[model samples]
Target: MAEYKMTTPLTDEDVEKLKIGDIVYLSGTIYTARDAAHKRLVDLINEGKELPFDLKGSVIYFVGPTPPKPGEPIGSAGPTTSYRMDSYSPILIKHGQKGMIGKGKRSEEVKEACKKYKAVYFGATGGAGALIAKRIKKAEVIAYPELGPEAIRKLEVEDFPVTVVNDCYGGDLYEEGRKKWAKA
Candidate 1:
């Protein structure tokens, strides 16, 4: 795999260079969306209305952060469970979304979508809230602020760490990596 430096509006070349289990320090523009926000976004797409943000080459982070401390952009930002969003991801992927950042096992449909759409899913370390929050340089609510933490926030980050969980070629690190260490 080739080395890639993450930047705003990542390209297929950036994503294609990543392999399962490779760590990345993502920078540039990333959009936050959770369960409630995803539901609304998918609904809008179904209605043929404009989405708050473009999906093409975009990365969606599955996070609901705590209130920021004074002079801070955010607090305790971390990936949430991904299964809850499985129903909605295919639609987003179909529309040109390229990447997703979250934790835990994903549905097969989601994996299929990644393969079909040439998208990737990254797994952020769970319980590393403070560490993760430090990587975020700025944050601002772009939509759905009434939903509080569920609001879609635009975050600019630096060296935001993640491991590639699912790759476009159907590689899954969590399962395969564990099996590699499993006793015969």
Candidate 2:
């Protein structure tokens, strides 16, 4: 699969070029939201209330980072399990959210949303929180401070590595990988 370096606020053209298993090193801004935050986001969408951040062309990371150490921008910032947000992901994707960063398989609904909306699901390395935090240049709580670590944060990342797990064209790395390895 091809590898690409992309910055955030991705366009349709950017999403279109990716396929499952492609390595992508993303740079620029991405937002943080775990299950609690996702529920809030979907609630806002259903109520026609303005979201904290624009959904169009945005990448949301499924993470609730730890407290930052002295002089650092963020603490251990690894991906959370993606499936927990599956219930809310389609709504976000339908509203123009372009990418999601997390680990594990997504539901059929989420994959369908990616296919229908020209969005992608990216999988960051699990258990590599400290290593991943090195790529994050900045992080600040943008909403829902009461949720503590689960609060939404805006993050500036540079060369943050991820794999395209589900693509806009209906490719799924988890399925393909199982098949490929099983045959071997």
Angstrom error at residue 149, model 1? 0.9
How displaced is residue 12 in candidate 2, in Å?
0.5
Residue 27 in model 2: lDDT: 98
Q: Where in model 2 is the C-alpha error above 4 Å?
A: none
Considering every candidate listed, which one attains the maximal lDDT? 2
lDDT for every model? 0.90, 0.95
RMSD of 2: 1.0
Per-residue lDDT tens digits of candidate 1, residues 36-144?
A: 9999999999999999998999999999999999999999998999899999998999998999999998899999999888889999988888889999999999999
Show the colliding residue pairs in model 1. none
- Candidate 2, residue 122: Cα displacement in angstroms equals 0.5
For this target, which candidate reaches the highest TM-score against the unseen true structure? Answer: 2
Q: Write one digit per residue (lDDT tens) for candidate 2, span 1-184.
A: 9999999899999999999999999999999999999999999998999999999999999998889989999999899899999999999999999999999989999999998889999999999999999999999999999999999999999999999999999899999999988953
lDDT accuracy of residue 95 in candidate 1: 92
